[model samples]
Target: MHYEKEDWNFELVVAGAGVGGISAALAAARLFRRVLLIEAGPEVGGTGVFSSVSLICNFRDSRGRPITSGIHRELFPAAYTHYNEQRVPTYDELALKSTYQQLLEAEPTLTVWTGCTVESADVENGRIQRLHLQGQQAGTVAAEVFLDATADGNLSAMAGMQYEIGREGDGKLQSATATFRVSGFDLLKLENPDIQTWPAIHSLRLELLPYYQALKDEGKTANPRQSITCFPYPDGKALLFNSTSVLGVDPTRPDSVSRGMEEGTRQANELFGAICGHPAFRQARLDYIAPRLGVREGRRITGEYILTAEDCLNTRHFGDMIAACAYSLDIHSPDGGATRLESIPGDGYYHIPYRSLIPVGCSNLLLASRCISGTHEAHSSYRIMASVSAIGEAAGVAASLAVIQRKKDVREVRPAHIRYVLQLRGQFTEGEVERIPLPASPQQEPPVSVEPNFKSNHD
Candidate 1:
């Protein structure tokens, strides 16, 4: 091994360039912290760009309030404007990647490392002392704070933090999705006009059922719009796919994941080909395939407090709310269909406690992304790209606070002050606690044990 003893330095090193990592890097950079955003792929936006998963999720709070404020408020609304009035632009991976690059390039304090993979890290006293990354120029980087923004919690796993994968009884997390883009056709000419909503295609799928069944019976079959969702884009094109199907994948194993990506792409293409041949998409042609597989579920690190489904249903707001999530529990199945948990009556927003992002026993590392503390069901809601971005912003601020205070444990920060700062920056904050009136119905009583999908071994 070649050893050139050159000390690498950074104030904050953000691992992964998805929404979470981008948010963290931007936040730290704004605070004048020398920041490095490390991405394994050639691009950023994580699954948002890679999987071609469109839509910024929901930005409002439970009470119909705009919860995703701050940078989120800026980015999301601008995205809406880029599209026609009737359509809200699903975040295009390439567009967002350019946006990330442009934003960071303008900031002198931040540097983005694309096509870089973190091989390992040197840890001492519950902190990352040195990080070894391989890319065009293999080198080491040292940072005061490390943000675990990898969708699979790679940093948390490297640091030996507690976490869970898949489900408990079944050990299956959720279905992995493969998104595909199709073009050269007038999607606006479809029998059903509206393209954004899922239900828009429901009737159309039924109308095309006879032809689909005929193909299925002849062994020349293709899944219909019933399994696929199409969102409109500019021109005569659309993103015509959805994340469905659960494959038990071991993320730590490179070979296993590699196989999954190949197979997932094949399935997505098969679906695309079927649609292209069908009457609905006969004129359509394959536009582009996602560079990364859409992984809807993965390893979740056990943090100080696991956000629960009960918390989501109750619309509970914590004193130290890092951000808020308004998306319902959107759980897709291995066979295609999905089940959604209805939002709480009245205002349907929920707050994310800062404690959920702080891993237990780990002093210097914080988690954002799908791996943050939450039950399986709760993670389904919190795992959305929009919410992860918000969480990453909060984690970044907290990490900066740690550096300033010279404190190790994240729990040492004051929740009240954090909220004040976030609010001042235009982030959503819980103003006060309120109790909801329960129905008098006896069956409506709460369950004896209510836990999130991913439960932490810690208290």
Candidate 2:
């Protein structure tokens, strides 16, 4: 048996280099904890860079308010070289990589490991005693606190942590799209005066109609080209398109995910080629494809407190609010169907409790990203980059506190302390926003409900 033994100790080991993992590393480093950021991919910026998402999702609250704060709020505008009318800024993938590198380089206590995959872990009692990692010819290394920042919650599953992979009732999740960039676009000539104008969009759509008709004639595709979603790239001369939707991609299954990525890429090129022949895009050229597949849904580990759809509509505020989210439910179907709830009403603000970040029955483990506690409906809103970044901040801070206090259970740490640190670091809070004045309540009796439909899938 060729077994190599090595021991590496760090205050925190953050698995995955996505927004959540990166934020965790940044936050933990600020708290003076030694953090090892491990990523399965060869490069950083998990989906942000690899998937080439042009802009950050709704950074503001329901009332068109900007809720992100702390390192995330600062990192937002910095990630973009320019912000157009789309509300989200256009991000250069290369620039984003450099930004993450620069930000991490500024942290003395931060160590980054690209192409590193965590195979398994050893958990004693509630705390994770050691985590085994392998990558780029490097053997295994251990750590004190292990964060399951992987978008798929890979680490949590390996540690025997309970989680759900898809929607409970329907056994489905929002569709996944493969994104690609097109070059040779003329920002100066394009009629899109603003990001929303998309005047050239209709032109591009018309150009793709003939191609779609041909495909349908040949029995290649059932969907038309008008169903595509295009966003302006940072350079303004380029357009990033997300038209292909891969359904039934179980994130936990590597084979399924790999297949989804391959199909998505193929679909991207097919769309790109169709657009290239158009009058508006006749001069266009294919820019680049994503290095990582864009995954819209995955295993969402059930936590101690799961935020629900009702909570979102109510704009409920928890006593231990660690962060806030305002984005509405955006569920895209694999059948090329897209659904979006533009607003959630009620001031467009909702609180993310500290309890949601900490997993139930597990110690020394924190979930960031889409895996954080919430119903499928709630996950749609919370899965956005800004909200995930906030969740990462909360988890990172909580981990730092756990290490400093030598606490075993993550729940042992006080929520107030986490809130205090987040506030000090400039994280937004409901307290900061003054509640709108409401009319006085009348002294009237209310009737009680005789029937209750409390059996919910979230339970």
Candidate 3:
């Protein structure tokens, strides 16, 4: 919907229309609450779309059961329906973006404002009273509960909430990347005829490595990555290169991000040119580079409970668990070193406690993105799209319950209540469930169906 310049009021206001923000808005709107989702970008879809990261990160546990469901499944139904470890699961960015638009538009009570940003927040005591917005809709928006899904904790920072950035030591964050798509490659020229499988894709990368290495040895590029890393599209015709590594790019700093984009794009082109020397890519075209650089780490908002690396390694369960993450702690080095990956033990997943979503000392604000409280090591695991979607869904439910129960503080809404709602919505949940009377909303719309096809020529 087109946003007009005017002051607005909502039961819930979500900042950032990325995956997390969209999930939060949809969850709340499905519950019959008035929701406003604000995005600074021209369209929905954050890193997963604009950055064009093709691979769908792990959301299933070791036993192959999905730990992250709910809105995530709705967005990427192919991932859930076509579960195959042999084939590398992926989605086209444009297809996912279309799904986001469909689900969002189906929610009658949900209003999405693209090209809008939450500039500031009005805090009274510990609660946020109003949000001053800029961009397409430049005015104040008051809400009973506010969710910070800006990925960089922009809204939480504006609300005077505490946050941590980067790793503990020198505060160096994960290296950023400028991803790009490439098509028109001859599959018959490749040793692996089936590039859709993990083994085949790995083989393809190895096959194209000599060219990339030659470029590096000749000092034709500034990228620090030693090897080529690319994922095949679901159709197996195209590939999304997530190989370039740009160091010292901080999301909170605009100047640093701008410089990073320039360097990363340069690296992307050099890499693309090098790969063209391969027999399979001789006729391949250099598809458009991702508009947004893929930033792995950002502001880790201080919450009621700070999740730690030990908690994840131990696979600890929380009584107030709201979500789960199955992805490994994959950290792209800040200094452009080798990537570090450590998988979760036992069930291959860990719980994301509800306390981690509630910003410290804030009564009505919730962290609904990767900005949620966690150590640097822990953040690397839950920062993936699937986990972030679950976090956003849980936060939305918690926020709505706070308004519905008429609780003065968000803390008053019990985790059991949130879990109950989540389980009813077909999301995976554990622990005790509190059966409570939920008020029916007349504004609630029926579920919207999404296309099963995952291919897109969106570029």
Instruction: Return the top candidate by lDDT.
Output: 3
- Which candidate would rank higher by TM-score, 1 or 3? 3
After the best TM-score superposition of candidate 3, give how far the Cα of residue 338 lies from its true spot, in angstroms.
0.5
Per-residue lDDT of model 3, residues 62-86, tens digit only: 9999998999999988899999989
- The model with the greater lDDT, 2 or 3, is 3
Q: Which numbered prediction scores highest in TM-score against the true structure?
A: 3
Query: Mind giving the per-residue lDDT tens digits that candidate 2 earns over 306-375?
Result: 8888888788999878888878877676444556565667778788988888777788899976788888
- Candidate 1: segments with Cα more than 4 A from true spot: 1-5, 79-89, 187-189, 194-226, 234-236, 243-246, 334-341, 431-459
For model 1, residues 377-407, the per-residue Cα lDDT tens digits are 8888888877887898888877765665555
Q: Would you estimate the TM-scores of all the predictions?
A: 0.85, 0.86, 0.95
Which portions of model 2 miss their true places by more than 4 Å? Answer: 1-5, 78-88, 137-140, 187-218, 222-226, 334-336, 431-459
Q: Give candidates' CA RMSD values in order.
A: 10.4, 10.4, 6.9
What is the lDDT ranking, best to worst? Answer: 3, 2, 1
Q: Which ten residues in a row have the lowest lDDT in candidate 3?
A: 450-459
